[model samples]
Target: MPELRTERLLLRAWQPADLAPWAAMNADPEVRRYFPEVLTREQSEASVARFQADLDERGWGWWAVEVRATGEFIGFTGLDPVDEDMPFTGVEAGWRLTRSAWGHGYATEAARAALTFGFTTLGLPEIVAVTTATNLRSQAVMRRLGMACDPADDFDDPDVPDGPLRRCVVYRISAGTALS
Candidate 1:
């Protein structure tokens, strides 16, 4: 995927040098709350490889979110495919950032750019975003992006391990809407 430049962020593919900070963010408990487990360094490397491969195949995925001014990798926010059966069969918008990047509106900014790519570049009719019930922060970002929570679309994530956090709330945003 080609790099996407926002006013303050550079959304692009991951690099080998992003491993340390990326792994650190994945391993952080605060940031990993919605994830089943903290990812190890090896897991993080493998995940980055998968992200790159997905981008190669589909032209987009959870892109590497970076600070344009300092050239620092913060985290990622972009579009990805969901394996679950749902209202839409296309891609979904999503984002994740390190603790330091929280409360900075990076998620909304990067995600809006991703939505533009999904609707304009990929020609997707709509995009979806799912989060655990406790993930109000991400949900708020979704709302700010003009995505509406579809209570009827809520379901337990088939991909989530059998546990307490399996239930999720799904949000939907159609293309050509007033999103952003």
Candidate 2:
């Protein structure tokens, strides 16, 4: 896949070295707070393997994000095709970063680049972002990306048990929309 450069980050394919930090991040309570559950090292590796396979086959999926200046593998931000069983199905923009990387604008910066690639490079008509109703941080990033929310689009995630995480909200942005 192609590498995307933002002001301070590089969105690129996953490397062998990213596994350790990626696993550590997935295991972090703060980082995984919004997720349904913390991922084990084995599960994290499996996730990486799945992402790598997707990128290898489709040339695009969740790309590993690195700091340009320090070359640190902070996290990942990219697009993924929503599962067919989901309430809404389409390309979704998502991000997950290490705890230390929080409070920085990395997620928004890298996500914008992914959205750009999705619209311009892939010619996708629209992209959606889904998060638990309580995940205000991610919802803020979606707003910054010019995604609009419609309460009617909200749905309970079938994969999540009936609880706070199950009540998810979706934000969407169409092609040609101006991004913040």
Candidate 3:
């Protein structure tokens, strides 16, 4: 799989060393605030397995993100086919970071790299980002990556239980408007 590098972060394939910190991040309440619930170690490991398989197959998918400076595993950011169960279909850009990594523009930086790969490398015509309506931090990062929100594209995710995370918002960026 192709490894992506930004000024301060690396978007690379998963390593055995990443498992511990990845589980810790998934178990973190703050880190999982937008999701249905925190994940168990088994769930986290299974997710890594799935992500790695996709990467191996297509050469691109969710990547383990790390700080290039200290080699600290921060989180993940990359492109994935929108879940088959979703109301929509297209590639989506996403990122998750450890709580300590927030407010540092790393999400935007890493996401921008993902978006670039989607638009240029994969020749995708558009990429969308979906998040809970309440996840303003991720929305902000989407906006920074030049993605625009259209209320018409928003929908309540059928998979999420009726709650704070059910209402979803989607931000979109077409290849034409993508920023390098």
Task: Point to the candidate with the largest lDDT.
Answer: 3
TM-score on alpha carbons, each prediction: 0.93, 0.97, 0.98
Task: Kindly list the per-residue Cα lDDT of model 1 for residues 7-95, writing each as its tens digit.
Answer: 99999888888889999999999999988989999999998999989888877888999999999999988888876565346677888
Q: Give the winner by TM-score: 2 or 3.
A: 3
Which tens-of-lDDT digit does each residue in 1-180 have in candidate 3? 899999999999999999999999999999999999999999999999999999999999999999999999999999999989888899999999999999999999999999999888999999999999999999999998899999998899998999989999999999999843
Cα error of candidate 1 at position 30, Å: 0.5
Which regions of candidate 1 deviate over 4 angstroms? 84-88
**Global fold similarity of model 1 (TM-score):** 0.93
Between prediction 1 and prediction 2, the one with superior lDDT is 2
Q: lDDT score of model 3? A: 0.94
TM-score of 3: 0.98
lDDT string, candidate 2, 1-180, tens digits: 688999999999899999999999998988999878999999999999999999989999999999999999999999999999898889999999998898899999999999999998999999999999999999999998999999999998888888778899999999978433
lDDT-based ranking, best first?
A: 3, 2, 1
Residue pairs with backbone overlap in model 3: none
Clashes of each: 0, 0, 0
